[model samples]
Target: MAAFTTGEAVALDLPIARVPTRATAFILDLVVQIGLALVLGLIATLMIALMGADSAWIDVAVTTVIVGTLVGYPVVCETLMRGRTVGKLVLGLRVVRTDGGPIDFRHALTRGLTGAIVDFWMLGGFGAIAVITSMCSPNARRVGDVLAGTVVIYGQKQLPAPALAVPPPWLANWVVQLDLSGIPEDLALAMRQYETRFRTLTPAAQVGLGQSLVITVCTRLGVAPPGNFPAMQIIGAVIAERQRRALTPPYSNPELLGLTPAALAAVRG
Candidate 1:
């Protein structure tokens, strides 16, 4: 259960979703990065050659470049290599503070090198640690995230709608038909409960809750839950309440359209 680090690596209340970047894709991201690095290295070499320093000074310059690469190479590599850097991109991830913040160079470098102890040495040992810890911790942090203060998220660039599954058969039927008037009031209540359980929680937590709700909601609603369904569907059913409740009088509580996220969070508190 990780918190969302909106832009920087601060503690987040929400967890960014994970897109599995397994061995094959990870290798691909690496190959792409290495290719980029080679181009950069060549440019560095060319600049040095064009300078045309004296033979003695040339040696010093080259030596300086080598040392600079030692410190700077990883920094460059980490950022360019993995969408964000080595440790993050490798795991199909990126770094952010628990407070919903973007990670800076210092944090990225620290996490990249320090996390190497796990990610590099045992070859996937660090990857394994990151995956497991993300599952175990409240903020879904990896070793580097814990030490450097960051969060590993999947899509740093896009903010997708949060989705949940439709547990009850009627709910599922309502989703596809776009007709909610026929649904019973009981199922509506079920949908509301279903939304609360999955939507507010982190993806890591939702993973399990999602599985359970699929079964429970189906049994009660006299329908089979979809195996491996998206979370958005559940939200859709709840959202369908707008259409379902349209039949009711407009004597209306503007709040009846649905629960605002703030209200939901308040209730969660």
Candidate 2:
């Protein structure tokens, strides 16, 4: 697992894809690339024969096939599929930026070029450098990942939804009243992740991270953090309020529906 703080100040804990899974994905991709190369090469050869092209043109066609298959496939796939090649999509893996965000075409191009020239083909000794680098790097990043500022992660793990957070009695009223529209989806996701992983954190980590999140949440809401409340409870209250608002009809006010703070807390519980 690797932890990254986003530009929005939200922390993400993403599961890194290790060498075994990556290698499997790579092999699958290699099979595809080879299959594509063979088919395209055959077509090119046929075209050349039909055109009565010279021997020099045959060499050019072969070089074009090799370079296109080796470099173009990954670049185009990752760019179009948002960081996933066909193999990666099948294996639930994705390449993302170091800050745990989706990668762009520039990043894909760099990774694809480095992979062909350095990680696997020209200078890699058939993946020796990639394996060694991944083994040494804590996040299992290869040469291309290091150079492109990207990492492959297990993107599609199915886990049960986290239980809704129950706001403390003292903060329930305040939480429901605050406007939550300002909180972005990414920040909300960060809050949910923090809540779900809260128990696994050490005591010191809990305090520090919880406090930091509380500050971030409060800032987004354009409010002040409560001085005396536990950060965990504050966070829970905010999340609970957000969930509550999601379920409630936009046109109907909870207050008008005769739901008091106590009732809201009970509903969340």
Q: Residue 7 of model 1: what lDDT?
A: 19
lDDT per model vs. reference? 0.50, 0.81
Worst 10 residues of 1 by lDDT: 3-12
Estimate, for each residue in 1-269, the C-alpha lDDT of model 1 and write its tens digit.
44342211122344454424433434555566556556666766787689875678656655555434433555665455432545455555655555433455766677656555665334446267657765676655556668777665663443322222224564555555443344453444444455545556788866666566555545545555544456546544535444334323553332222223443344335
Q: Residue 24 lDDT in model 2?
A: 95
Q: Which stretches of candidate 1 lie over 4 Å from their true place?
A: 1-13, 16-19, 22-28, 44-94, 116-118, 121-140, 155-269
Task: Flag clash pairs in model 2.
Answer: none
Give candidates' CA RMSD values in order: 17.2, 10.0
Clashes (backbone N, CA, C under 3 Å), per candidate, total 30, 0
Instruction: Give the TM-score of each candidate.
Output: 0.36, 0.59
